[model samples]
Target: MKILCISDQIDPLIYSNTIKDRFSDMDLVLSAGDLPLDYLEFIVTTLNKPLLFVFGNHNLKELPFYRHSFEDRFRFYSPQEERDALTSGAIHVGSKIHREGNLIVMGLGGSLRYNNGPNQFTNRQMNFEILKLVPRLLFNKLVYGRFLDILLTHAPPLGIHDKEDPCHRGFKAFLWFMRLFKPRFLIHGHIHLYDLQDVRTTKYHETQVINAYSHYIIDTGAAS
Candidate 1:
C-alpha cells in the first residue's frame, strides 16, 4: 500500500489547493500531529484521501481558523482512546492495530515531558505507559493476536533522532519496545529541521525505523 505520512509543519506548497494532483493517489495519509484543522479538512475534502492523525501540544486552541466554520477533519487523542472512530467524533493516540493491504500497524503519538497542552508525556511516565502494554497487550502474542507489523509515533524512539527541545523529545519506552516486540517498521516525526531528510531504513533490534516527514513517503512491503 502507498502511505503518505506527514507531520510537524504546515506548508502552503504541499496542502495548498494548487498542489491537488501531487497527492491525490495516496491510499491513506497519516499526520504525526501539530498541523491545523484546516490542513486536515483539505486532505479529506480537497485531496480526497482518508485522513488519520493525532494532535500535537499546540492543537488545543480554539483558533480563529475554526471559528468561522466546522468540518469533520479534526479529531482529538491522548493515551487512552483507541479504534478507528471517524464518525464517532473521537480521536485516538494515533495508536492501535491497523491493517493496510498486508501490513499490520500500531502507532504512538505525542511528545515527551512538556509544560503544555493536549499531548505530552514525561520519560518515566511514558515508560510506565509502555509497561502497561507489554505483557498486557504488546509482548503477549496470545492476546494481541499477531506480533505488530509496524510501529508509528510522533516522536522517534530515544537516541536515533530524539532531542530534549521545545518541539522534539523521544520516548524511552519506545526504545524498550524496540527490544521487546521488534516490529517490521517504526515511523515517526516532530524533530523538524534537525534531520528533515527521510532516514534510510535502519533496524532497531529487528524493526526498521524511519523518519516520515511532510515532503516524504514511507513505502514498505515486499512490493516496495
Candidate 2:
C-alpha cells in the first residue's frame, strides 16, 4: 500500500489543485505533526482518504476540538462531530492506537519537555504514556502476530534522528518501545531539515525511522 506522510511545513505541491493528480494513488495519509488544521483539512477533502495524525509542539490551535469530550479517548468522531470540528474529516490519533484494516499504528505526539508548553512531555511522562498502551499492544500481538506496524510521533527516537538540544532531543522510551514491540516504522516530525544532503530516513534494529519534515511517500507491503 502507498501512504503519504506530511509534517512540519506545508508543501505547495500538496496544497495545490494538482495534489489530486500527484497523489491520487495513495491509500492512506499520515501527519507526523506541527501542521495547520486547514492544510490537513484540504488534504482530507481533496484526497478523500483516511488521514490520521498527531499534534506537534506547534500549530495546535485545534487540539482542544479533538479532546472536547473524555469519551474521545475511546471513540473516533462521529460524522457530524467530524464536520463540526472543521478538521475536514481528519482524525487525531495522538496517544492512541488506531487500526486501519490490518495495519496497526500507535501515536505518541509531543516534543521533549523544554518549557511550559502544550504537547510537551518529559521522558518519564512519555514512558508512562507508552505503558498505558501495553495491554492493547499485547492483545494486538496475540491476535495479529505483531504488536504494531507503525509508531507515529512528533519527536524522533533518541540518538537516531534527534539533536542534542533539549527541545528537539528524542525520547529514550521510544528506543525501548522498539526493542519491545518491534514496530516496522517509527515516523516522526520535529527537526526541520534544510540541506538536501541531511539524512531523513534511518534504519535502527527492526524499525525504519523517518523524518516527515515536509512530506514523504512510503510504500508498504501490507494490505490496505
Candidate 3:
C-alpha cells in the first residue's frame, strides 16, 4: 500500500486543487501532528481515503473535542451538532491502536515536556501512556504474530533523530518501546528540516524511523 505521511508544515503540493491527481494512488493518509484539522479533513474528503492522525504541540484548536468526556462534550455542543465541527471525517489516533486492513497502527502523540503546554509530556508520563497500551500490543503479538506495524508519534525517539534541545528532544520511552515491540515503522513529526543534507529517515533496530516534516510517501511494497 502507498501511504502519504504529512506533518508540521502544509505542503503546497498537497493543499492544491490537483491533490487528488497528484496523489491519486495513495492508499492511506497519516498525519504525525502539528497540522491544521481542516487540512486533514480536506484530504480525507477529497481522496475519499482513511486518515489517521495524532496531536502535536501546535495547531490544536480542536483538541478538547477528543479529550473531553461525552457529558462534557455535550456542554459545548450536541453530538450531532459537533459531528462536522472539527476534522469532521478524520480519526484521531493519539494514545490508541487502530487497524486498517492488515496494518496495525499505534499512536503516541506529543513532545517532551518543555513547558506547561498542551500535548507535552514528561518521560515518566509518556511511559505511563505506553503502559496503557501494553495489553493491546501483547494481544496483537499473539493474534497477528507481531506487536504492531507502525508506531506513530509527534516526536522522534531519543538519540535517533532527536536534537539536544529540551523542546525538540525525543523521548527515551520511545526507544524502549521500539526495542521491545519492534514495529515495522516509527513515523514521527516535530523536527523540521531546512537543508536537503539533513537526514530524515533512519534505521534503528528492526524499525524504520521516518520524520514526516512536510510530506513523505511510504511505499510498503517497495520496502517489503
Candidate 4:
C-alpha cells in the first residue's frame, strides 16, 4: 500500500488545498509526531483516509472555539472537551499494536528524557514501556507467524539517525528492540532534516529505518 508519512514541521502545500493534488495516490497516513492537531484533523478530513499518530514531547492544547457572544465571543471548553478533541478521530498507536489489513504496526511514542517535558522518558522508563509490549508481540508471533511489520516512534534508535544532544538522542533500548523484534521497518521522527543531500533511509539488521521528517512516501507492498 502507498503510505504518506508526516512529522515535525507542517508543509505549506498540505495546509493550502494542494495536498489532494500532490498526494492523490496516498493510501494511508502515518504521523510520527510533533504536529498540530488541527493540521492532522484537516489532512484526515481532506483525504478521508485512516490516520494513525503518536505523541511527541508535547501535549495537546485547547483550541479556541467561537460562540455567539459580544464581549467574550470565544468559548472555552471544559476538560472533557479538551480530552475529546485530543482523541476525536485519529488513532493513538503509542505502546500498542494495530493492524491495517496486512500491515502490523507497533507504536512506541516519545523521545529521550531531557527536561520535564511531556512524552519524554528516561532510558529505564523507555525500557519498561517496551517490556509491556513483549507479551503481545509474542502472541503475534505465535498467531500471525511474525512479530511485527512496522515499529513507529517519535525518536530514532540509538546511534542511528540521532543527534548528539540529550533531547535528540535516541533510545538505547531501541537497539535491543530492533535486534530482537526485527520489524520490517522502524519509522521515526525527531531529528529534522534541513538539506536535501541528507540521507533518510538506513538498514538495521533486516529492518529499514526511515526518518519521517516533514513528509515521506513509501510502498509497503514493495517492501520485503
Candidate 5:
C-alpha cells in the first residue's frame, strides 16, 4: 500500500489543485498535525481517499492567518464527542483505534505541556491519555488477533526524534506505548527539520519511527 503522510508545514505540491494528478495513486493519507483545516479539507475532498489525522499543539492556538469561521480556537475533538468539531473533512484518529482495511492504526496527539494550551500535556497527563487506549488495544489483541500497525501522534517519542525543549519534547509515555504495543510504524510530527542530513527515521525495537514533518510516502509492502 502506498500511503502519503503529511504534517507541520503545508506543501505547495499537495496544496495545489494538481494534487489529484500527483497523488492519485496513493492508497491513503495520514496527517501528523500542525496544518491548516483548509489544507486538510482540500486533501480529503480532492484526493477522495481515507485520511486520518491527529491534532498538533498549534491547532488550538489563535493564529492570525487561520480562518476564524471554525467554532472555537480548538481544532480536535474529544473521544467522548459524538461528532468531530474540526472543520477538516477527514476522520480524526486522536486517542482512538481505527482499522482501515488490513491495517490497524492508533492515534495519540499533542505535545509536552509548555503552557496552558489545549492538545498540550504533561508527562502524567500524557500517560493518562495513553492509558485510555489500553482497553481498546487489549480488545483488538483478543478479538482481531492483532496489536497495531501504525501509531500516529503529533510529537515524537522520547529519545527518538524529539528535542530538548519543553514545547518540542517527546512524550515519555510514547516510548512505553511503542515498547508494549510494538507497532510496525510509529509516525509523528512537531520537530521540524530544514536540513536533509538531519535524522528522520529511527528503529525502536520492532518498530520504525518516522518524522513526517512536511510530507512523506510509505510503501507498506503487504497488509500485515
Candidate 6:
C-alpha cells in the first residue's frame, strides 16, 4: 500500500481542490498536526482517503470533531503504549509487526507540551507514563523479535530530528525508543522548518526517519 504523510500546516484543499490537486497520487494520508478541521473533512469528503494525525502545539479545539469525523481511519497513540504521548489523541492504525502488511503503525498526536488542550502530558509526566507502560504493554507483538515496521509519535526524537529554536523541542524519550525498538521507520511532525522544507530523511540506528508534510508519498509494499 502507498502511504502519504503530512503535518505542521493547514490542509489547503478543503475550500476547493488547491492542495489536493498537487497530491492526488497519495493512497493514504498521515498528518502530524497544525492543520485546519475543514482540511481534514476534505480528506474524508473530496479526497476520500484514510488519514491519521497528531496535533501541534498551536492547533486548538480540533480533537472532538476530528474523532467524530474520521472515526474509522484516524488513529493516535497513548502514553500507555509509549512514553512519548499526546492529549486529544487516539490510536487509529496498525502496530510494529502489523505494518509488515499495510505496515503496523501507532501515533502520538500533539506536541512536546500542550499550550492548551485536555489530554496533554508533560515531558517528565510522559516519561513516568512510559515507565508504567513499557515492559508491560510494549514489545508484546510479532515485531518484538527484530524491529517494528513503523512507530509513529507526534513528538520528534531528541536531537536526531530537532532544530535550533525554542519552540522546536524534540522528544528525548522518543529518541530512546527509536534506539531500543529500531523500527523500520519513525514518522513525526511539529518542527516548522521540516514542514517548510517539504522533505527530511535520515538513516539512524538502522531506521529511516521521515518528516511528512503538505505532499509526500511512498510505496512501501514494493520497497521491501
Question: Judged by TM-score, which candidate is best?
Answer: 3
Q: Over the stretch 11-105, how does candidate 2's per-residue lDDT look in tens digits?
A: 99999999999999999999999998888889999999999999999986667666453544675656675565664577888989999877899
Query: What CA RMSD would you report for each candidate?
Result: 7.2, 3.9, 2.5, 6.4, 5.3, 8.2
- TM-score per prediction, in order, is 0.71, 0.91, 0.93, 0.88, 0.87, 0.68
Total residue pair clashes for candidate 1: 1
> Candidate 2 vs candidate 5: which has greater lDDT?
2
Q: For model 1, how does the per-residue alpha-carbon lDDT over 1-224 read when each residue is reduced to its tens digit? A: 57777777776667676657677666667777667656666667776666556655566443212222234246554333322223322224354555555555666667876774445778776676566555435443675465676676787887776666755767778887878777877777776664536353567888877766554566664442
**Model 5: runs farther than 4 Å from truth?**
61-87
Candidate 6 similarity to native, TM-score: 0.68
Choose 2 or 5, whichever is better by TM-score: 2
How many collisions per candidate?
Answer: 1, 0, 0, 0, 0, 14
C-alpha lDDT of all candidate models, in order: 0.63, 0.89, 0.90, 0.83, 0.84, 0.57
- Candidate 5, residues 24-103, lDDT tens digits: the string is 99988999988866678899999989899888888644221232334444555354341334555787788889999889
Worst 10 residues of 3 by lDDT: 68-77
Model 4 Cα RMSD, 1 decimal: 6.4
Candidates 3 and 4 compared: the better one by TM-score is: 3
TM-score for candidate 2, residues paired by index: 0.91
Model 6 misplaced stretches (Cα beyond 4 Å): 11-22, 64-101, 114-120, 128-140, 143-147, 194-199, 222-224
lDDT at residue 44 of model 1 (Cα atoms): 71
RMSD of 5: 5.3
